[model samples]
Target: MQADIYKENGFFLDEWQLLEDEQALPTEPGRFLVSLERFVAAPEAFASLPEIAILVRAGDDVTVLAPHLDRFTMVAIEFAAFSDGRGYSSARLLRQRLCYHGELRAVGDVLLDQIPLMRRCGFDAFKVVHEPTRRALETGHLAEVPLYLQPAARPDEQPAGARAWARSPAGLAR
Candidate 1:
């Protein structure tokens, strides 16, 4: 429960608890986050629980979740490592192709430098354990260039009467 993001997102502390694989479901009957494997193992059990979130790992085909998208109230994509970029694609697919409207969260190894890009990829919340990243988020001192050159899930536009280097992702799409 360490995501420091927009105050309105209500991620200051994780309201949903992440339930790892093989872990027993809590008896308190609260919102829980479970991996896709656990959900698939016994979909019925998870379905009975209200407000369950699904965690999608890297390299997993997001399309597989299309059928069950409605069952999930939230989707957490694991980064595992900062160098791995597969999570970005997962977020995009969930948002663009699958038309998932649930809460999208970035978890595991989340870094400050990647927050903006993650946001563009449709991640609105983050579970960052990195100290530096947490500090940066708390201080609202993100070192972002604010000039993306590639098209992303979240559209961006070029500023009128601005330098070419300032071109946004929307401009490149055309």
Candidate 2:
């Protein structure tokens, strides 16, 4: 069974059902998250499906998918590997540039250490397969520092310090 982790009231909780690889697309009406490739290849097929979501890989071009953002209830960005940081950029683009308001999820290679950064980048849900990471999330001991030096896509984030540039018209520090 695949377990999905999501944050609720400042704590992580498991509450999601990931569609299996071999399962056929549900035409009978239901919620399902399809791979980015599948969705891109045949968008018309899934366009009318109820509660559709898409899983974005590291190399996928988010810009191309911008037009379809409103069609999905959620967007899952795959980390693939901890060293690969493209997912972070993708999340930022989706939230900041595209203005996606639905749930943004982080999946694969989701370590506890990366959760804080992922959240800052606009990931509200995380699919943590690692046991240690799961434990850390459950215990609420992810060792995350609330302070961030840079401004992120989320409006809720506060600058690390008060600076003239930080409060400038652009709202970004030099």
Candidate 3:
């Protein structure tokens, strides 16, 4: 089944070819996404695979994947359920702490209501399966509030002026 792909620009594009669960890893180098377990089990095999991406589950530690970040062209965080929000923190850490500059995507259980927050958390792409969510994304039906209370991982985004503490030095008085 083909999913609707949303990029940071809020445009729908089908450039990526998702690897199905039943499909085996391609022998030739090409763009592909693999499960975290499969990639961890045999990191060397994927090391040489060009344009490789990995699917990280909510519980998986981002630190373990840090060393191999340079090898991946993208890192997709899996959201098993809409209630599972651990993926948000993972994306933030990958962007703010690990400094992963590649594509950060949200896969599985992606909904229209969550796209705005997901982008703030540093997800640049989304693989949404629901038709309503896809339409909402395509038509700009998302009721996004541009104001942010806290500073986001993206350096270009400044914190809201209301939160003076965000801009002040840790030990300095506002």
> How high is each candidate's TM-score?
0.80, 0.81, 0.81
- Compared with the true structure, what per-residue lDDT tens digits does model 1 show for residues 95-150? 99999998898988888788888887888888777888777667777766567666
- Model 3 Cα lDDT, one tens digit per residue, 36-154: 77777778866566788888898998877878899888899999999999999999989989999999989999998898889889999988888999788778787686687757777
- What local lDDT does model 3 show for residue 107? 90
The positional error of residue 55 in candidate 1, measured at the CA in angstroms, is 1.0
Instruction: Give residue 34's lDDT in candidate 2 (0 to 100).
Output: 80
User: What does candidate 2's lDDT look like per residue over 1-174, in tens digits?
Assistant: 445565644435433345655677776666687888887777897766768888888899888888788898889899889999999999999999999999998989998889888888989988778988877767777677667777777676676553646567786734
The residue ranges of model 3 lying beyond 4 angstroms of the native Cα positions read 1-3, 9-24, 161-174
**Candidate 1 Cα misplacement greater than 4 A, ranges:** 1-11, 156-174
Quantify all predictions' global Cα lDDT against the true fold: 0.79, 0.79, 0.82
* Greater-lDDT candidate between 2 and 3: 3
Tell how far residue 162 is off in model 3, in angstroms.
Answer: 7.3
